[model samples]
Target chain A: MESQIPRSKSQLPIPDYQSSNSATLKVDRVTKRYGSGATEVTAVQEVSLTVAAGEIVLIRGPSGSGKTTLLSMLGALLKPTEGTIRLDGTTLSELAENRLPDIRLRQFGFIFQDFNLLSALTALENVALVAALAGAKGKEARKRAAGLMTDLGLKERLNFLPEKLSGGEKQRVAIARALVNDPAIILADEPTANLDSKIGHEIMRLLRRIAKEQNRSVVIVSHDQRIKDIADRVLWLEDGQFKEMVTMATDPVCGMAVEREKAAAQLELDGVTYYFCSRGCRAEFEAERRGQVVGDRLTLQVGRP
Target chain B: MILVAFRNLFQNKIRLVISVGGVALALLLILALDAVFSGVEQQVTAYIDYSGADVFVSQEGVRNMHMASSALSASVASKVKAVSGVASVTPILYVTNVVVADEERNLAYIIGLPPNAAMGGPWRVVAGERIPSDGEAIIDAGVAEKSGIGLGDEVKILGEEFTVAGLSDGTATLINSVAFISKRDFAKLRGDPGTVSYLLVKVEPGGSPERVAARIEAQVSEVTAQTRPAFAAQERRVIKDMSTDVIAIMNLTGFLIGMAVMALTVYTATLSRRAEYGVLKALGARNGHLYRTVLAQALISVALGFGLGLAFTLLLAAIVPQLGTNLSLLISGASLVKVSLVSLVIAAFSAILPIRQIAGLDPAMVFRGK
Candidate 1:
C-alpha cells in the first residue's frame, strides 16, 4: 500500500507558475497624496512592482523611501491614488471596499518590523488568531500554532505575552503568524530590523527557508542590508522608483545569503566548524562557545556590521 | 480580530472605567427623571381609577377636582341625576379653610361626603372609623400626622367647630393630604348650607360612560360631564402646560449633556489609541475590523453605564423616602429599552469619524513613525 499511489500533476504540492499565472500581486504606477494644495504632499509616487508565485522579493529602501507603501499596495491595504493592484489576476482598484477584508483574510499574510502583536494576546494566541481568520477552527488553529511554534523553537514561550518576549522571539512569532494561512504571498515590512545581528540572520533564514520549502512568495520591505542576501531577488527603490534587481547568495554559517558581499559571522571553537558575519560577531561567538557549560547554549552580543 | 478587540478594551482599564462611570451617571439621571414622572402619572391615574365614577360632573371649564375656582352648587347634582342612564349622583363639596387648635393651625381642604351617598364617601380609611355624625370629621393620615391631630381632638374651622372621629388614607385635597368632614359640617363651615362643589355620577353598569357624559352635558345646562379617563388626560395636559418650558429646557439640557459625555468618551478612547489602531491596520487588520472593534468597545461601555444607572436610580428611590410613596422615580420597560438603544446609536455613530482616521492611516507613515 505504501507505493501504490500514482501522483497526478494537479495533486502535486509543488508551486507552479503556469497554473498560478494569475499574478498574485501587481502594483502599477501607484501614487498617493495627502491633504490639499499648499498643504499637500506626496507619500508614494509612481511605484510599480509585481510578485508572482514562488518568488521571494525584497523591497529595499531607507526611511521614507516608500518601501512600506509599495508593500501596502501589494497587500491590498491601501488604494493607489493613480494606479491599480491586481491580486490573483483581479485588479483590487475595481473591487468594492466591503470585499477588501475578505480578500486580505483569504489571500495574504502580513508581518511587521515592530512585530505588531496585540500585547493582550499570548504568542500562541496570536498565531492561532491568523489561523482562525484564515478559516481554521479555533481549537484546531491553536493546536497547529502550538506545533508550529514548537518547531520554531518557541515551545517554552507559547503562553508568554508579546511584552514578555525578546525581540528575536517576537519576530519568530510574527513569522509563525504570517505562515499560519500558507498564503500565496507573505508581506513583511522590515521583519528582522528589530533583532540583533545574530537573531536577525536567524529570522531571515527562516523566511527564506519557508519561501523555498513551502513555495510561497514573501515580499519584505527592509533597510536592513543584512537580509539582502537571503532574498531570492533584491528590488532596490529610490524615491518610489525601481532601481535594479539582483540575485542573492547564501551565508556559509546559517546557509542564508546576505547580498552586497555580506557574510554570516564565523567562529572557531574547540576544533569545531562555525561561522560569523564579522570579526566582532566571531569574537562574541567565540566567547559564548568557550563560556558555555555542557548542556546550555551560550549567547553573546553579536553586533550588526 | 474581535477577540483582539475585546483584549484592547480590557487593556485600557482607566479609560474604560471613566467611560463607564460617566455613562452610568447619565443613565441614572435619565432613569430617575423618568421614574418620578411615571410615578406621578400613575398616582394620578390610580386615584381616578379607584374613584369608581364613570363621569365627573363639574362646573363648565373646571380643570381638576380640588381647585377652589372650579365649584358648582349642590343643585347641579339633582339635575345631573335626572339624566338618562345616571344610576346615582352625589354632590362632593371641596373648600379650603384654616384649622385652629392649641396654637397649631394650617390651611387644609375640607371635603364633604353626602349622607347615604355611595358616590361621595371615603374609599379607604387607615384609622378609627368614617365620620359618624354632624360636627365629626375623618382626617387624612397625611394631614393628621402633620397637624398633630388625633381622635377626640377638637378643632375650630371657619367659625365652625368639629371633633376628629376617624382617619382616612389616600384622601387629600392637595396631593392626597386633605381632611374629610360630614356634608352638614362642610356646609356649616363654609357658611353656606344650600350649595356644594361638583358632582360624582355613577352610570348603570351597561351604559357607555362617554354616551352618558354627552347626554348629561346636553340635558344639564352650564355643567360639563367629563368621563374619568378623559379628565385624567386633561389633568396631565394641564400640568404639562404649566411646567412645559422648564421641563423642556431641562430635558434638552440633559440630552445635550448626555451626548457630549458619550462623544467625549468615544473621542478620547479613539484618540488615545490612535497609534495602536495604526499598528493594527499595518499588521493587516482591515478598516472594517478596526471599526467594529471600536464600536464594540463603546457598546460595552454604554451597556455597563446603563446597568449602573438603573441600579443607581433604584438606590436613590430607596435612600430618599420622598421618592418612594408619592414621588416615584419611574423606569418603564419602554424607557429602559429606549435609553439603551439611544446609547448604542450614539456609540455607533460617534465611532464613525474615529474609525475613518484608522482607515485613512498610511501604513508607510505609520511604520516609519512619520
Candidate 2:
C-alpha cells in the first residue's frame, strides 16, 4: 500500500526561524499513561515527531486516539510518562513545576474551540491580558494587542466584548491573542469545532498565513477534514501510535471512528461490514436489531494497539 | 492584575452587590452589638468616673463596689483625710438594694452621704438639689422618668420612706440606677455606729492621686486605697467579667456569620468565573498571581463592608438616644481595632477555598473544555 503520510505539495516556502532559539518543538518517543497496576491505561504510546518553525503539522486520529494528550505534552501542559519533549533548547520534563507556566507563556500560544476569551474584557483586553502576564506594561500590551488585532482585521471590534463578537470574529480575536505574544508555536485543539464550514475554512487559511509570515510553527489537533490541505504534514494516529496507513470506519452503534482492522467487533449485514469500538456497542446493536440480524458474518477480536 | 481583579467584579455586578451587602450587614450586627457593650461598660462605671474624688479608700479585700461590701472604720476615714496630699475625704455609705416609687420597683445603688458632703452626692443633679437631707432621696433622672416618679415623689429605700428631692443625670444603666440619701438616716436604719463603705478622697492641687492613694494605703489600716480611675476600672472589670461570655458568644456568632457571608460571596464569585480562570491559567498566569487577584477581591469586599458598617453604627449612635432607650451605643477606637483585625481575617480566609479551586485548575481545560 502507498503510504498515506501526506505532506503539503503547494510549493509554499517554509521559512526557518532557527535564528530565534524559540521556534522548534521536538518529541522523542513520548508516552503518556494514566492510573497504575491493574487499572493502568496507556493514552499515548511512544509517539515521536518533530515540529519545525514555519511548519504546520496536523495530527488526525480516531476518537480517543490520544491526539489531545500529545498536544498537551507538546505544549508543556502535561508531562510524558516516558521519553523526552524538548521545545527550543529546554527539556520540559526536567523543568520545575513552577517554571512551566512562564515557559508556556513565552513559548506556546493556545487557541481553543470555545474561543475562551474572558467574557468580562473587551476583545482587545482579552488579547492584551496574555501580554500583561508576561510583564508587558499596560500601554505596551494594549498597543501590541491592537497591532495584532488590526492585522487580523479586527480593529473595529477591539473594544467589543467576546459576547458581542460573532463566531468568526471571536475566532479571529483568538488568533490575534495567540499571536500577540509572538510565541514560538500555536497549539490549537479542535479550533474549528464551533464554527460553520466557511468560517472554519477561513480560520484554517488564517492559521496557514500566520505560520508562513510569522515563521512560527503550529501544531493543530483537529478532526475537521476541510482544514487538512493547510497542514504541512498529516500524521494518522491509531491506538496512540503513528500509523503508516489505515482506513477509518464509523461505529454504527456509537458513532465513533474506528480502524477496521483493530475494531473490537464487526458484523456483515446486507453485504456491508459494520465495525464497533467496543463489545458493549456491538451487543447493543445486536439487541436493537434482533429481528433483522440473522447475520451473514460476525467476528470478535482483541483490540489492537 | 488589579484591573483584572476589578473586572472580575464588574462582570457580575449583582453578585458584587450581594457580597458587599452581606458583609456589611454582618459587620453591622457586630458593631451595633459592640456599641451596646461599650455603653454598658461606661454606664456601669459612671458614678466612679464622674465622682470628684481623686482616690477611693475601701475596706481591704474589697477591690470594686459592684456586688461588693466594704466596711471601713470611721477612724480609717480620719486617717485618709490626714494623709499628705489629701485635700479632703468624704466618707459615704453605700448599698445595692431595691428602690420603689408609686409601686414601681427598680434596682438602685443607694448611697448615703453627710449634709453638705464635699463630693459624695450626685455629681450632676439635673432637676433638684445636690445633697439630700435626711428622708430626702436623689435618684437618677433616667430612672425617675422611666418609673414615672418626679421630684418630691415618695420612694422607699431599704424599707425607709424618703421624698425624692433631686434627679441625677447619667447615673442610670440597664442593670441598676444610683440614688443618694443622708448618712444619718443610713446609720440610723442600719444601726452601724462607726463604719463607712468608702472614703472619697480629693487630692490637693498638683498632687498625684496615685501617690496620694499609696500614702493613704500606708497611713491607714484595714483599707485598700486606689486612684479614682483605677477604682472605676475595677468596677468596669467586675461588670465586664459578669458579661464576658455573653458578649463573646454574640460577637463570635456575628463574626462567624460575617466571615461565612464573605466566604460564600467570594466563593460564588470565583466559581462563576472558573472558565476565565482556566483561561488565565492556560495563558500562563501563575497560581501566585491568581491567588493575589482573588485575595484582592476579597479584601475589597471586606474593606467596603467595614466602612459601611462603621457608618451605620455611627449613624445609630447619633440617633438612637433620641428615641429614648437606655441602650446608649457608641464606638471606641479599641473596638475599631478589634473589628479591623476580624475584617482582615475574613478577607484572608475568604480567599482560601477560591485559591484551592484555582490551584487545582488545569490549563488543559482551555483545550478540552468550552
Best by the TM-score measure: 2
Over the stretch B1-370, how does candidate 1's per-residue lDDT look in tens digits? 6676667667789877777788787767667776666655655455455667889888887856534345677778778888999998878777666666556676666668777667656678787766436887776666676667788888776667778888777654325445667788777766887777868889998999999999988999888789989877776666556666865565556555656776787777777767667765554566767788778877777788788888888888676555234354556786677677767776777677777777777654555554
Error of 1 at B259 (Å): 1.6
| Tens digit per residue, CA lDDT, model 2, A150-253 | 76778799999899999989988988787777789999988899999878867876777667667688888889975555666678887899996435455676
Interface RMSD of each: 2.9, 1.0
lDDT of 2 at B47: 87
Q: Using Cα atoms with residue i matched to residue i, what is each candidate's TM-score against the true structure?
A: 0.76, 0.83
Query: Candidate 1 residues A220-295, lDDT tens each?
Result: 8888887665676788887777777775644333343444334444333455434344655466555555676574
Two-chain DockQ for model 2: 0.50
Off by over 4 Å in 2: A1-22, A138-140, A150-159, A197-202, A244-305
Model 2, B1-370: lDDT tens digits are 7777788877888888888888888888888888888898998888898878899999997888999999988888777877899999899999999899878899989899998899877878889889999899999888888889898899999998999999998888877889999999998888995998999999999999999999888888888999988998999888889888987888798789889998998898899889889888888899999999899999989998899989989999889888867778979888899889989999999999999999999887676673
Question: Worst lDDT window (10 residues) for model 2 chain B?
Answer: B361-370
Deviation in angstroms for B35 in model 2?
Answer: 2.2
Question: lDDT at B180 for candidate 1?
Answer: 65
